[model samples]
Target: MGHAICEELEAHGENFIVIDKNESRTETLRDEKFDASVGDISHKDLIEKISMPPTIFVVSSDILANISFTERVRKQYPNVTIFARAADESTKEELVKKGANHVILSQEIVSNVVYDKIKKLEDSADAQKLLRVLKETEEKLAIIVHDNPDPDALASALALKYIGNGVNVESDILYGRGIGHQENRSFVNLLDIELKKIEDTDLNRYNKYAFIDTVPDANNSASVTPNIIIDHHEVTESIPDADFVLIDANCGSTAAIMTKFIRELNVDIPKEIASALLYGIRSDTQDFTRNTSPADLTAAAYLYPHVNYELLKQITSSVISVGTLNVLGDAIKNRKMRGSYLLSNVGFIRDSDTLSQAADYLLRLEGVTTAVVYGIIEDSGIYISARTKDIRVSMGEVLKEAFKDVGSAGGHNGMAAAQIPLGIFDSVKDKDSLIYLCEEAVTKRFLAVVGAEDEK
Candidate 1:
């Protein structure tokens, strides 16, 4: 149960330092990607040892630990949102009284899941509710994804389009960035998925919009009131008001939730959609290695028969485009190592996806425990992508502190991103200085995270 929650947080880009009283409780997550400490969160000495202040305090270990540990962490990190597991409503009340911001009753969750499943059995009310929303002939629905939409974002957008259109609504899937990754481009092309920049889109033309696989405040690209929201990340308190929110932290990918939502409508899972959704789950969950959920497995099982295994095989072998390779090469050439960390600069790139891939590629090196990739993107700004094998160093905290004065940047423990706008980008070459500054800024941020820099 504990590992499942940690996996969800990791998947959704929320970094956390997990504390377990019994060291063995975190054994399942050992050697896995995350910042997990074995000790007592309530212990003052142990709390002081924490390098990154937790944003979400999860107390899913035990009832007593839940109350004591959550209160302790919440008191230390006053702004942190507390999520505690409870046995009953009374327990929830007690947790809330003790300072938990969000109290999740274990029994209530079971009841709700059973209730939803039973609603499926008893009557088709759930279907009718969405069908009513979908049958609004005057409404146009645009399924939007956040900046530089990833596989999860793409898959969620597609799944939403299928359902919204099936129920008689006009829908189109939109993205804020170009699909440049080899696997992403192949998946998009093979699926015939049409993606467009969100800036060029008129959200006002469509009264109904759905945010797929992302939170609005989390990424400004999909900044709109969503009629429907679907995501599979750690729960955030400030989720925007939506007609419906299908955020199952237990699921590995939002695509899994979207696929199930579509399946309930009894529509045929198109070959293209199934393929895209499967790829989304595979990519977001790191081929089910990082954060595979039971729901993800169930949805994959349903989609497997409909997917084109042949196409998937072909996609795997698809060659990387020349443009991506150029940027990737530059990133590697500029790679610099500092102890367990490796920082690289890709002077300029066309998209954030390339920067992220560069970071991922760099982190694969044996000596690199933390990898930060930066690049300049014309007039848009400087983009930074950081990934880490260091389970202790929260990349989210590092980026947040590093870019706190410069720009916005925060995410899960292992992966995070930051961007700072440039005053001018009149020519392509002007990006060189910004890229260098971005790289240097990341280094400074690392120094802040580990400790103050000293003359070496």
Candidate 2:
């Protein structure tokens, strides 16, 4: 196993050292022009003899030996990454518990390699289809993002623009609504991305339209037919009848799918663009905490070195307003727990985006796996934002089924929102009445939809 690993690393032109207790193995590695040492890796003195600690220590010996070596390394140099090979589930767990950064089962690795090869072939075919679309189009195209575009939507749009530029096809990134959240605004400003409001732009000026991060039937998307739809959201509703649809719900983020395009096209990703795409993937996947897939991690890895770390720091660390903080406090104070689900009403808020933020915060409460926060937005309407860690619940479908008759609603499985126009509750007399009406209507409808046992 050690010899095979050394050979593979050498094939990739990577510098590595081999440490083995067996003289013959050490001699064999040395014969192959590799740095070899004969010693027990678990010995502190033996490891210290190596000039410098490696960035990654590969443990390919038997499970017991690997675990022993990993534990020893972690004790001395806790920061060093350990990649250990395990023969079975028991050994895998032991290696992981002993501080292996990654534990690989030989069988699983072999199977995954085969699966990846097949996936690559399929990706190549799709890349050809994408190139055909770009090359065949003679006129300019419009890439429309969902309303109140977030980092994921904006970054995906930017990536598509890059792809369009590579093919010599002109494209403009457009959004149906303005960015409202503090983080989103910071992302756009820091990245220097230009997104035109679709309402202001003349749609007819563009010969074809494309949708990124959202489909035509989405409540947040503009009411326009698209020639291409590239999104990572689930197929919960009717998709846009685009000439080419590249929807991969398994990717976790639209940016992941767009990043794949950038790589397949062999186009250079600028530092600004790389930073934006990395931020998009992190934001959409909640830093790989919510609904993340392997592809999302892979895309993030690809963009890591090229990204502008300083700009990403600024974008993520942007300050939130006192109003948003107050709303979050109010949501927490008014929260009612039902099983693992918590529901709250913030009374009133001018920025409806605050509801989503509050819902996300409430979901972190102990014992609460799902949270629904609602508030009345001044002049606009009543808005409901829901978030869930429970895989059984599809937040988007829940919101749709709860209030589809009264308002526009839809989102991903883990997060969703709904809006009901104030005109629907015309019977309200005063501020107190309006608040009570909103609370009653929203709570009853949401609880009914989610089928919670009780609300307290």
Candidate 3:
């Protein structure tokens, strides 16, 4: 087992030394061009003579020898990282207590390999199921995304449409509300992804409907029952029944799930599709800084080589629009700070997406650990965008607990948003009074949930 590990390390071009108690075994390793020495690993004289690197690995056949070597090395070099092999759980625990930074168990490694294989098989089955459903579509298919669709939603919808095309089922990407973010608009225009407004499209023409990146809900304007639903958000409300539903809260983005399907089904990924999916994963995961998983990283890695870097740069570096700048100005001027929390009112705005940008910007303030920006739309309701770096707080839960009775709210731990219908607030004609009431109500509700209300 240790020889196999050494071969792998050598194949990866890593520098490592081997120690063995048997002189013939050490000579054999040296003859094979390995840095080998015949010495007892637990001997203080042997350890003192050898130059120790920042990391040491003790993977002998004997668990007792491994533990002794780990303890001796830790006592001599307290700062070095030690990886020790163990025979069982008890030996693993003993190695850890003796200051082994990592314990590698063959059984655990085998179990992980088995789990990965099973997961791959399950994913393949899911892909086949989705393809079967797409092939059954009589007329055209409608791949609808959430309102004001972001890159993740757009990419996933496009991936589904690509898959649908493979089975000769024509599909259209549909979205409710306008894409208000500058970067989102650039992504669509640059990629030449065709999308139709849900209000403008004839819903009756499509025989099959697939919702991507969002489930059927009151806010999404999903009038008809969906045949399919694929999403990554935590399911707050019970999902409406669908023929094929793949909702993985563990995934960082819906694009990652779609990437898995494309790979499992052996569909050739186009460069444009790869670029879009990679950007979708990056955007939704905040470049893997928030709510990311190994699946998301693996998906990104697979898509990276095929992505168009030039187009990606253009989409990500889109200039802020005049409306967004105006909103940011308002947010900065009206900022209110209480302890580590900062709240700002951007006043009435046509674009709600700018609120999140402003919240992200406000979170960079020196002392602020949590930032919230809110605004009201004319016919719509008050929109709230929140961001937090405090690991103790879940922004999603905070927003949900604060406004569950009055509106809809949910997201990841670090970022969340909410929308409350303008019920009684619509009657307030005075702009100043409306801003005051919105600020007071929003601040009190939000701060109360985070337990920062008592702070002056």
lDDT of each: 0.72, 0.81, 0.87
What candidate 3 gets wrong by more than 4 Å, as runs, is 1-109
lDDT (10s digit) by residue, model 3, range 177-294: 7788899999999999998988998899999899898878634666988999998888777888888999888899999999999999998999999999999999999999989988
Candidate 1 lDDT, 340-456, residue by residue in tens: 677787776787788887888888988778788888777688788888767777676777777776676756667778777664333435445655666666677666676644412
Top TM-score prediction, candidate number: 3
Top lDDT prediction, candidate number? 3
TM values, all candidates: 0.68, 0.72, 0.75
State each model's C-alpha RMSD to the native.
Answer: 11.5, 16.0, 14.5
- For candidate 2, lDDT tens digit of each residue in 1-456? 455555665664556777788899788878878998888765667767775543444455566877887887788887565667788999999988988867777776643343344356456656667777877778888998887788999999999888888889998999864576899989889888888887798888888788889888574546677888898887667775667888887788999988888887777899999999999999989999887988899999999989988999999899998878999999989998878889898887777778889988888888999999998866668888899989988998888988988887877889987889899877775877898899888888888988864655
- Estimate the TM-score for candidate 3: 0.75
Which of the predicted structures, 1 or 2, would earn the higher lDDT when compared with the native?
A: 2
Cα displacement (Å) at residue 172, model 3: 1.7
